[model samples]
Target: MLILTCPYCGVDAEETELAPGGEAHLKRFGPGASDEEFRDYLFARENPKGVHFERWRHAHGCGKWFHAARCTMTLEVFGTYPAQTTKPPKAIREAITAKRPGWTWREFE
Candidate 1:
């Protein structure tokens, strides 16, 4: 069972109690943006086999959204942080680095 600790309520909820919100740290495009940019924003996503960042909502708990870093293959969670953050927390990055050296995801390394 996959368990994620909600940063808002500090509750370690199971995946069944939460809702997956797709990829995190996406570059959103709004009005006046090119059609290609909009398409990429909506459809383009990274499905790496290694460490990945995702958005999760604590539906059955605090109802707040947060980000989680974990291995897609192993399901080994590095850490979780508030979704309001523009980037992963330093501690989370460090934890990922400790487990997977030379890891680089998007702009995070």
Candidate 2:
């Protein structure tokens, strides 16, 4: 299994300790964007053969959200960071927190 180093937890964890959160840095459509544009925005993905950005969760440890650059074929973790790296929207934060045990927020400092 790939060893994931938590920037905050200061521990190298097994791949089972994390969860895949899909593509990262997806931008929300502006009011002026067309419906097709919005649909493409929501449905399209890079699926890069080389390096790709993916969201991950510390399922069994600090229980925080984060992103990682992983190789899809090899499942190698390139890096990881706290979910706050992008300062998630309120709704996103709520959704993540809800999935987490106790539904709490852990500030990444």
> What's the true lDDT of residue 56 in model 2?
74
TM-score result, candidate 2: 0.63
What is the clash count of model 1? 0
Q: CA lDDT, every prediction? A: 0.92, 0.67
Tens-digit lDDT track of model 2 for 9-106: 87787878877678876666999999988998889877776445677777888887777655667765556666666643454444444444453323
Candidate 2 at residue 57, lDDT?
A: 77
Report the number of the highest-lDDT candidate: 1
Q: State every prediction's TM-score relative to the real structure.
A: 0.96, 0.63
Cα lDDT of candidate 2 equals 0.67
Error of 1 at 23 (Å): 0.3
- Ten residues in sequence with the least summed lDDT for candidate 2: 100-109
